[model samples]
Target: MKVNRFQVNVILGIANGIISALQTLWFIPYIKSFLGNEAYGYVSVINGLVNTLMIISVSVGVMSTRFIVVNLEQGNKKKASHYYSTEFFSLLIIGLLISILGIILSFNLRKVMNISSGYYNDVQILFLMTLFSFLIQLISAPFSASFYVKNSLFITYLIFICDYLSRIMMTIFLFSNGEKVIWSSALATDLVYLGMILIYYIYTRKNLPELILSKSLFKIKYLWDVMRSGLWVGISYAGNVMLSSLTTYFSNIFCGVIITGIYSAIMQLNIIENTVLSVLISSILPKMFKLYSNDDNQSLYNYVIDSMILTTLFIGLISSGIVVYGSDFMSLWMGKEFVKYRLLIVLTVIYLPFTLPSQVINQVFTVKNKVAIPAIATLLFGMLNVFLIIIFTKWLNLGIYGIAISAVIVQVLRDNIFYPLYLKNIINRVKWKLSIPFLIGVVYMALGISICFLVKKVIVPNTILSFSLSVIVSGILLFLLALTLYRKKEHLGG
Candidate 1:
């Protein structure tokens, strides 16, 4: 049997997913055990901030992928090279500026995050290390874009898995050796990224020689073109950073570092959902770009529709498991103290209904180059979410659940309800049928909620053996349902 590109991507995605999940599972406990909860919270904050800085790289990367693939489709190797080289140098400059910013910010670590004076040095060291690691990734963004342009994510993911595994082992060694400084873990992470820079450089030279650097590739015109295309992408990323990082910052300032630690644990588990969706997005985006460029409107519509339904069903199933067994899983995985965060965990699932489907829609927006509206909306709503979090926590005394609720509300309104409507107008060929997935998501979530009760009756919630059986059974059933729906919808759409 010959595996298709989509199959290859999915396989790689799953591999990356498992590796990421395992790393999170292993390292969170290791950090908590060795470095303690306060340090864990600081680590989470640092990581969040680093990812926030990634806005610069991601903006350039999205444009690089778009321009490179589109230009290649036109058989314009020079244009692709121009896009690659321009973005590469641009990201280098961005990385340097951020590195300087990181150094300056490192000095103010104690005041910035309210670090206790005793642990001030540790936080500063970790912050600096994280900054360096982020800087490396920033510079490597354009090279990573080469893989995406070629639709060769499997190779990229393969390298990443190796990197992740190496980091895990190194961190474990450091922890066991009493080198419990959080900066050591960050250093281990940077080393992997440095290795990736080298690997991607060699690989791009071998396979995508056209994407290599040249003086002719460094055109001011192409640099401006990239910046123009990437402007909204950068805005969207800034909004996302605000939403996620501000949540951590809020928890730290309002609730305390311990709660931030707890919140981070919840988010780490929640990342499993994002991991799967990210794989799906990466797998489909190159195709999405191609379909749009070819003016294959109907195929693009069907593709978006099918993907929306499939992502909804998949997320609904996982959300079901989380709804039914999240508390138990958290208790077992994190610690018994986490059982109290059950409601917050459940609230996070609300995002799945809106977020998962929107992941597919985002690709459509990107392909159409109409990302400005959605990006601006995200910024506005993200700020709204932050404001709501403040009001609910400080004024209404609602706490972290307030923050989670605000996020879900804003996402549903903006990304879910608003963005799809916007896409219908932009794509012009899309119809009201696109709304079907929303209805499906609602039903799925309801069923998932109902299953929580049915599950409790069938299997003891906290029992390891019983919970495992429930997940397996639910997963199989959900997978079958998703397959049936996908095939049925695809045939009907065709």
Candidate 2:
């Protein structure tokens, strides 16, 4: 059987995610060896700052993809080109403004984050370099959307892999040649983004010739049209950043750079897991947009439910493995010191089943252009998360664990309860019993964790080889168990 474009996209996306994740995992130890853990903490904060600032750019990119895909699907090439041009020019202006803001913020980073005097100057320079890279990325966001418009997501993933590889090689080369500074990593990133932007522009011009970059195509009306949707999207992105990335900043404020570095290290696993899962889900967005455009509500509903199940299943399986074997893996990878923070790893990932499936619902809101309430809800809950983190850390003295706990509580409230109920209102034609899928996800995760824990007790994998074998065995068993449970549920429904 020949695989279709969707299958190809999923496969390539997973490959890209895996490669990118491995590169990150490797860089953690490598960077720690050279920059030391304290510098690593500062680097994490700088990255978080840059990512937080990029919310507008990401929102514009998202809305551009949605509008371009919808119009292209409807055979309105001119409308699509208008959106493309508007997104490009709008980001160009926004990117410059944000770059200035980022520079000013870079000066004050020492005040907010507990950066030591020794690394402050180097960290400031690194922040500036990273900010410049973000400017390039912001401007190139529209060019990247062309891949989505053409349903060639694999090309995007391929470019991402290439970018990651080049960054790795450049960082290695720089460090080997007696340039083992944190700013060097930022320089590598800067060069890679510059190269990737050229690739994106060339691809868009060659393949999506209709989307020409002309001053005439840039319309204020189109920009307003995008912002009508993109504003809420940007709010949602801000909320998400507050929930996830700001944890590093908070960790620094409450616990100091050493503890912050440890927390950031553990959170990397969670980040990689979420990125991989999101990549898989994103492979379906063009299809989702097409389905919604066609007014195939039933098919759209089916697609949503199917994506939720698959996403939940993958999260369950992967999270269970992490909860069970994470300590051992970290011990082997990062040394024996990390074994003590196994609880942090568990706290980082346990809420995934409750939260991540809601990403599918988020995409639904985007396609339907009904994001106002959800965006507000997300922003409010995100603020609540910040408040709770402060209370838990400062008043209650829970330290970094308090940050993790705050995330869990807020995510369950927003993603599990609020998002589903709100989605019900938007897609009101069908009685969406959203709880069942969440319930099933909880059950699957609980079962997998229990079984894997038991298996771990029996097989104590000390060496890397034994750990690898155990992971393989347990993974297969869990997959089989999940398959059985899913089939049984299908049979009962049938």
Q: Number of clashing residue pairs in every model?
A: 0, 0
lDDT of 2 by residue, 107-208 (tens): 898667787877888888988998998898888888866666677889878877887787688778988999877777678778878888998899999987
**Alpha-carbon RMSD to native, per candidate:** 2.0, 1.8
State model 1's lDDT: 0.78
What overall lDDT, based on C-alpha atoms, would model 2 receive against the true structure?
0.83
What would the TM-scores of all predictions be?
A: 0.95, 0.96
Residue 104 in model 2: lDDT = 85
lDDT of 1 by residue, 1-494 (tens): 99988889889888998898888788878788876777778888887767777787777778777887778766788888888888888888888888888888888776667576667898888888888877876777767766666778898788778867987888878877877776666777778888888988887788777776866678899988877868888888888877766678778887887888888888876788888888888888878877877888889988888788877877777887787778888898888988888889988876686567777987887787777888888788778888898898899988878888887887778767778788877878767678777777777777766766575677675667777887777677666666666566644442
Candidate 2 worst ten-residue window by lDDT: 485-494
In candidate 2, the residue pairs with backbone N, CA or C atoms under 3 Å apart (3 or more residues apart, or in different chains) clash, namely none
RMSD of candidate 2 to the truth, in angstroms, is 1.8
lDDT of 2 at 428: 75
lDDT of each: 0.78, 0.83
* Candidate 1's TM-score: 0.95
Report the C-alpha displacement of residue 205, candidate 2, in angstroms: 2.2
